[model samples]
Target: MSEALQILQKYWKHDRFRPLQQEIIDSVLSGQDTFALMPTGGGKSICFQIPAMVNKGICLVISPLIALMKDQVANLQKRDIKAIALTGGIKSNEMIDLLDNCQFGNYKFLYLSPERLQSDWILDRIKNLPINLIAIDEAHCVSQWGHDFRPAYLKISGLKDHFPNVPFLALTATATPKAKEEIITELGLHNPKLFQKSFARKNIAYMVFETDDKLFRIEQILKKNPQSSIIYVRNRKSCLEISTQLRYLGFKATFYHGGLSSKEKDKNMLLWMQDEVQVIVATNAFGMGIDKSNVKTVIHIQLPENLENYYQEAGRSGRNGDKAFAVLLTNPSDIAQTENQFINILPDKAFLNSIYIKLCNYFQIAYGEGINEQFSFNLNAFCLKYKFPVLKTYNAMQFLDRQGVITLSQEFSEKITLQFIIPSKEVIRYTSLNPHDEEILLAILRTYPGIYEMQTAFNLPLIAKKSNHPETQIYAVLQKLKEKGIIDYHSRNNDSTLIFNEIREDERTINRVAKYLENQNTLKKEQFKSVLKYIKEDKVCKSKLILNYFGEKTTEDCGICSYCITKKNKKTNTIPLSKEILLIITNEELNSREIQNRINNKSDDVIFAIQQLLENEKIILKPNNKYILKL
Candidate 1:
């Protein structure tokens, strides 16, 4: 057996690789820079992972999502693999220790976000490590044309200069031809071998419904498909509203959003993943790196910002190759809302400048200063102080990030850590004096072995369950313990981290990337138009439209999509519409409008038959817009 295959089976417990995965792995193993375009759930991680294991030195993975990095690291550790993720908000000493571990501690995989590349200290440290390969996940973000563009991705190419011999692997689930070319050019890949899996998903039946009553339609769909499902909304308010309504209707449902605490998010996600909940209504924040294979349905309550986003979200269904449904519920108003939300309200250059200036003021940084400085940013406080809209301010910050002016790390869940300040024996004596807090403290000590040595994540729910106490009581006990100098605790539920990429500047900085901003706006307009076209288009198969948008040409229609199904139903109605119209006209010399009103068929079918009759001289149209049978 091949070394890659052996490692895959041993660690991942898979006998064979998915389509195109082994080939990609071979390219990496052969020391060739490779670009891989795999769909969601295509096992993209294994392509780089198996080869990294087969090779000698450590693999450096540059990813965009901290949650994804943490999850993958946890999973790898569970399989007895040494993996570590260096994300934002870590202390300087902790980061030094992590880097030291990566260099000396036989760690096989080291995952870090692209934004970290801005730190010269980090780069200097990385240059000393025995790095074998560099893998970039969500590689499309390096391209200007990609949906999720990040400026830090551009800095990834510098690694090539640092480690000239190490091969590079770029992987993403959504990328167009334009984005693909830009990724290669931006990353400076040398003679890269490219592997692209077909984007067609045969098991997913794409359905779009234009209904006046969306709630009723959703209910109908949920009733029909009573399996694990995900319903995506546009905002947090809707997430709560829909989940509440579903529960009221006696369906097992939960809600998730970025506003939820990490503990709540994990608990809710665990419930759904364990089959304790039938549905999860959430915003787009819910399903990144989620590995649920049995999700039978994925429904979108509104049109997404772009086809790439929609495709990725819809592709979440049917991952196990079982028959599943991807349904989109929208109306005329939704199309308008999509345009307004994504395009019309987009931050202009002036607004972007205002936001940037306000951000500097909020952080109390003067002009031409604050380079490489990081701050714990409170987004709500900033918005409230400046009286700016939250969403628009956030978008402006993202634009600044794309221009390399700043790095925004919005980690929804912070990692809370606690360390015992007093000796274990002293803690035992103190807890004995305060008998009410004894159970919780003992639970914490029993659950986490190194709590006295180093700070660990604070899991209130787990501690509460173990101590047979409510979460409120557990929190009270922890607070009391902290007040008495028994332990030191830091909570990660609030605040985002921001790093100034360069010296603070005024509006001229915006001018430096003016052309890039213009291109982004143009891309946004085109993406909105494409989404609108997908919704209004009735002559083409829905699946075909999506495939074409992704640069895939298909002459054969997915015969099961909503469009094809509607057309098939029209053809199989078993009654000839022309004859039906003629029969109605024979009884009375009626106008075309009257004839249509008298028929029991669809209005479009009736109008089509009338036009055919008029063309064939079977019926005559009078000047008063009336139709009569010719004798």
Candidate 2:
């Protein structure tokens, strides 16, 4: 048994390995750059983790998502493995301490977001550590051609020079052959071992429903399945509204989106995880590291921007090796909405330039002024004040973030309400005459967390939500407490965005780059339509069609697909065309339908004959489905 197999057995308690896992692990163990294109549930993590565990040094993992990093670190720790996360939430002093521990501690894994690569301290100190492998999760992000390209990913290839001997391992759940090639080139892999798994998942049944009434369809889907499922919408408002509707339908539903307060998000997530909630209506923000094993269904209320995202998101269900359903519900009008979204997106170069200029102005710095300054920004307000479209501004900021010009941290922020914990000093002396008012002050302190940490004004809604006391009563108590000077009570709320670390302005405007980017966006719109074509196509086996997309040749259609299902229902008794049967025909060549007419069978029966004859090179097929016998 190999070290990886042994580790898998010892840690994961699995007696046998799955199909492609061992091959992938062997490639990694050989100390070569490895690209593993396993399907979503194909144990992509263990391939790297086992090698990391048995290897001589720490495996540095660069992930695009903060939540995914945190989840992986937590899971590793649960397995008695030492791991650390270099993320934004940590204070500078805390980061220093964590880095020190990573350098000296027995930590086997250190997960950092790609954006963190620009940190001077991280870059300066990493060369000193005994790093054996650099695992790039979501490796497709390195390619502009990929659906989810990140500018930060392009910078990661630079690490090869700093650690010349460290092997690079890039892993992703979905990638086309083009994406695969780009990942390899961008990572600077020298003759890397590529492990490409079949994109087929037998247990998942793909069904698409065209519907004009989305809410009715959702309600109907829920009424039928009622199992734990995820309802994915395109935006934040939909998440809240759909979840609320599910609740009204008397279903236990919760919602998740980037817009929610951190506390509410966490609480709601916990509720769903513990099965306190049976359904979660959410935006794409919901399911990166969600490890629920038995999600019986995953329904997409809206079409994703691309197939890669849809595959990854839908693949989240039926992980327990149980049969599950993945459905896409779309109305014809959605095409207009999607088209509008694509057209409204900012040109990448233009957006980046705007960000550079705005950051320069906001920080009171000259064009080249920003070097290492890090400051929080309100993206919406900034865009509004600058008269820029918010959606375009947000995408630009994201592009800038990917370009290493900024770091956008997805954080959980909450609104908090506080009632005065105590009366004013002058009133406290007077209130000391009566204990009832003093009890109110004590109750106020008990109600709110971290209220004294800041002196910012708070909102009344927050107080109403938190105090379990009426808003009017809380306000009265706050006024009395203010009068007595016992404590300051107020409401506070916070929103988060990516903070850029760039020169306030750039002398070199990349307008040419923006034009090129605009062209690419136009190309992506066409590509997105291709994805739609693939999903809506009902004539080919799902697996074979996907395989064909990646340049795989498999003549055998998967007997279990939407195409196969339709064929089966036709119940045409198809017979294979043997050489003996073909020789009986008088003509040297024949159209397949004409041949079928001679055979006195349905056109469906002719398909098998056509496929077999073509495969055997006994005949040539013309563009119009006519066939000619080989000499």
TM-score of each: 0.78, 0.74
The local distance difference test score of each candidate is 0.84, 0.71
Could you list the CA RMSD of all candidates, in the order they appear? 13.6, 15.0
Worst 10 residues of 1 by lDDT: 408-417
Per-residue lDDT for 503 in model 2? 52
Q: How many backbone clashes does candidate 2 have?
A: 16
- Tens-place lDDT per residue, model 1, 464-485, is 6779899789778778878888
- Per-residue C-alpha lDDT of model 2 across residues 30-73, encoded as one tens digit per residue: 88888998877777888789889888889999998787888899
Q: Ten consecutive residues with minimal summed lDDT in candidate 2?
A: 411-420
Model 1 collision count: 0
